[model samples]
Target: MSDYIVEFNNVTKEYVRQVALQNISLKLPRGKLIGLVGPNGSGKSTILKLIAGLVRPSRGSVRVNGRQANRMLASEISYLSELDVLYPFYTVAETIDFNAGLFRNFDMAKAREMMSFMQLDPGKKVKDLSKGNRGRLKIILSLARQVPLILMDEPLSGLDPLVRDSIIQSLISYLDLEQQTVIMTTHEVTEVEPILDTVVAIQNGQLRGMAEVEEIRMTHGQSLVEWMKHNLA
Candidate 1:
């Protein structure tokens, strides 16, 4: 068995005239919380889509768990997009039940626990919830699943710092790092920095650098944001 859960072998993803990812290659190890950090339009989401089998690479190969990435990997991956995909007509509890029905590995106990942890009102309609609460629910939906890979795109987009803090705590508490690998893309670098084991920096549809989170602080005396700035410069 290989150590990597995801392998991108010189992958390139192009759409129309725009190239999202250009000849990128990296091996993402198993059982770690990784942050895919980059500026907007820097291909962060593209990477997650490829991993989730929502999109294919225009060139090279994308493999998840040694198999070619495809819709069949749905059982292996849980993807949370930046956009709102929740059924607004359903109540919070109903939405949880809906997701529980879709996947056998969906942990109902964990989902309820996270709903409570997120302070989401079960009886309230999804449309009635605040944006922050909706974001919390999205996190719960993705994290409650017992899967090898969790892909989150801009998970902390609109929330205030305090809410982000709680969400980050839940991310640490709920995940089993021995079994799961979380790849999250977020603009809130400073906020999510504490939970990340590794950081992969991408810019202008190309790989800029990759580094361990602790190494940057101990060796370079820099935060993830500072490291990104230096690399992107």
Candidate 2:
């Protein structure tokens, strides 16, 4: 079995004429929280989409759990999209049921726990949810699965500071890092710095650097936020 939960080998992604990622090669170690950090349009989300198999690379390969990314791999991976994936008409209960029916690894009890933790009403429809709640719902849905890998795009985006902090704390407490590898894309370097084990910095579709949080602090003598700014500057 591959030691890495996810791997990108010389990957390139394009949208029509625009190159989103180019000649990217990286491997994410199993069972850790990894932050993909960069500015807007820096290929951070593209990398997550590629690993989730939502998009195909124009070149090279994306592997999950030792297999090429595909529909089968979808069961082993959970993707929290930057955009809403929930149908507006679905009630919270129905939405959970719908997703629970799809992935065999899904745990309904865990889903309920997450909903309760997030203070989401089971009768509430997706359309009625606030931005923070919607984000929470997405996170709950993703974490409900007993998958080996998780990909999230901007998990902290457009949230109140208190709400963001709560979500982060819940993630740290709820996630079993020994069994799951979470790779998330975000611009909130400072907010996520505390939770991340590794940081992958990208700019203009190329890697700026990849380092452990400790490495940044010990070797570089800078916080992840400061190191990111300095590296990307």
Give a tens-digit lDDT track for model 1, residues 2-71: 8999999999999998999999999999999999988899999999999989999999999999999999
Candidate 1, run of 10 with poorest lDDT: 158-167
All candidates' TM-scores?
Answer: 0.99, 0.96
Pairs that collide in candidate 2 are none
lDDT of 2 by residue, 3-96 (tens): 8888889998989979999899999899899999888999999898888788899999988888899766777889898988899999999999
Off by over 4 Å in 1: none
- Report model 1's TM-score to 2 decimal places: 0.99
* Best TM-score among the predictions, by candidate number: 1
Residue ranges of candidate 2 with Cα displaced over 4 Å: none
